[model samples]
Target: MRLRNATIAAASAVALVLAVPTSANAATGDFLYKVGPGIPAGLADPASGECINLFGATEANPAFAPENFTSSTATVFLDFDCDGDVFYVMNPGKRLGDRLKLRSVVFS
Candidate 1:
């Protein structure tokens, strides 16, 4: 009986460890951009290796003047869902002009 109880406890501990959620692999800083003539907005500590569509992006009003302050490089796209041709590649601590508009982005 004692051996069985010890084994059960060990199995429960292993299961608990496996059930624990892991932290996301996110960039350590913000990614700033502008939409139309509005003030600057950005994502704080955005997740890495995922496509992030701009909140208010469209053909008439696209996101522009991107500034990457994260630890990872940022790849911006002209189409939604990070599809279409690559608009530009912004490295960490880099900024771009308004001429570079985008609809989605991903951090690597």
Candidate 2:
């Protein structure tokens, strides 16, 4: 009877310890961009990076100048200057190699 009661008590303690995190206070942190499956996302794909085409030329067969979209992509931080809208590509794992490519973006 003593051994069985001891085993039950130990199991109960373990369960309570594991459940503490869920009951504790939550934390807030800066957002990090999540890349694609192969490459990091949010980080603009430099293969076609450029100043003028940051938004994209869209039509006119390149518009004023012929540019490539992959040459100037970069990693950017997301911070709100004031009351405005913004978007971030969220990564589940947020691995280094995988966070540089564009993944599913989250918008507010």
Candidate 3:
């Protein structure tokens, strides 16, 4: 659902919008990218078949895979701060909230 800022009641009031790109890019190889938007909340299980191997990934930092998220697939990416529910994507000018499907994906 696309949530408008509460203060936009006035007709003259300009709505603030954040423009986020629909796609993201991550490097390839050993770097374990923290894939999110999996079925269950939290990092994906390495054993699960969804993880992608980020070439030079590390515990603190990991290589990631780019995702082409659609309306049905928001799959927002976040750091450890997304422990509970909801995460903020730094992309600018985007409206609507897509359920984050956290998945730890590995690639060949």
Candidate 4:
């Protein structure tokens, strides 16, 4: 009986450990961009492997001049949902010109 109880407790502990979700890794540093003619605004320590829509972004007034300071590569999209054929892949510590407009971004 004692051995059976111990086995069950060990199995339960293992199951619990396996069921716990792990945290996703994030890109370190800021992802800066400008809205219209405004000053640069950014996300600090943004999460990787997720789509991030720029704040206050729209078709007429999209975010532009992206500066990717994060450790991972960033993909900027012309659409809010990170979709469409218009996209730019930016390397870490790199930046784009003001002509490059974007509404969403994803990091790798």
Candidate 5:
């Protein structure tokens, strides 16, 4: 019947509209970087996830402090050219590489 065909066509249109996928903020276990013993690292935006690389860049202008033997403690920084990887300053002069430890990473 004409009415039956029309009803079926309407239902199909509605189903097609509902079937279209929409973007959603979902948690997936697919993308992750395991650093340290058992660490979970991932991006807030999973769609733009990719490999993160860190490169150590020599300081163009290193410390200009005069060389002297004094019993003084100070913090030193190990400069790095972060290609895409995150950096955390857990301690002074700490550089990340194979099996390096990390304290914490905060993203705002």
Candidate 6:
């Protein structure tokens, strides 16, 4: 039947040009930082081939700096001044104030 309808329209035009969405599958952007005891700020400054990724962080070390209350460690530092900073490391026995509560995640 006309070469099977021209081989199914050339395999549906190569599956519609491989499903079109290119740019390496495009869609990359994310930023979020939170802290309760105060100390969490960094975002807004990245354009020049774009680069920034902290990606993970979670803190809730009441006051365990050197007490070694089991485990605790968090980090997210980028740019220093260009914008991006969230560092928390207290699990053993490090006491100061506020009680520390942080949540960070960044990517661009």
TM-scores of all models? 0.77, 0.23, 0.20, 0.77, 0.27, 0.25
Candidate 3 clashes: the total is 32
Q: Over the stretch 1-108, how does candidate 6's per-residue lDDT look in tens digits?
A: 999999999999999999997653211222224332343433333222233342233232211111112222223232332244545433322332433333331222
Per-residue accuracy of model 3 over 1-108 as CA lDDT, tens digit each:
123444345422443233434333332212122233332121222222233333333345422333422222223333332243533332212333343232223221
- Candidate scoring better on TM-score of 3 and 6: 6
Per-residue CA lDDT of model 5 for 1-108, tens digit only, reads: 999999999999999999998755332222223333344343333222222221211234222111111122112122332222533322312233434322222211
Tell me the tens digit of each residue's lDDT in model 4 across 9-84.
9999999999999865899999999986867789999989999999978888898999999999999999988999
Task: Give the Å error, residue 93, model 2.
Answer: 30
Superior candidate under lDDT, 1 versus 2 = 1
Off by over 4 Å in 3: 1-58, 69-71, 80-108
Model 1 regions lying over 4 Å from their true place = 1-23
Q: What stretches of model 5 exceed 4 Å from their correct place?
A: 25-41, 44-108
Against the hidden true structure, what lDDT does model 1 obtain?
0.91
**CA error at residue 19 for candidate 2, angstroms:** 1.0
List the lowest-lDDT window of 10 residues for candidate 1: 34-43
Q: Residue 71 in model 4: shift from native, Å?
A: 0.1
List the candidate 2 regions with Cα displacement exceeding 4 Å: 22-108
- lDDT (Cα, tens digit) per residue for candidate 1, span 1-108: 999999999999999999998877999899999987866789999999999999878878889999999999999999999998667888999999989989999999
For model 5, the local distance difference test gives 0.32
Q: How does residue 13 of candidate 3 score in lDDT?
A: 47
Model 4 segments beyond 4 Å from truth? Answer: 1-24
All candidates: CA RMSD in angstroms?
A: 2.6, 14.6, 17.1, 3.1, 16.0, 11.3
Residue 41 displacement (Å), model 3: 20
Clashing pairs in 5: none
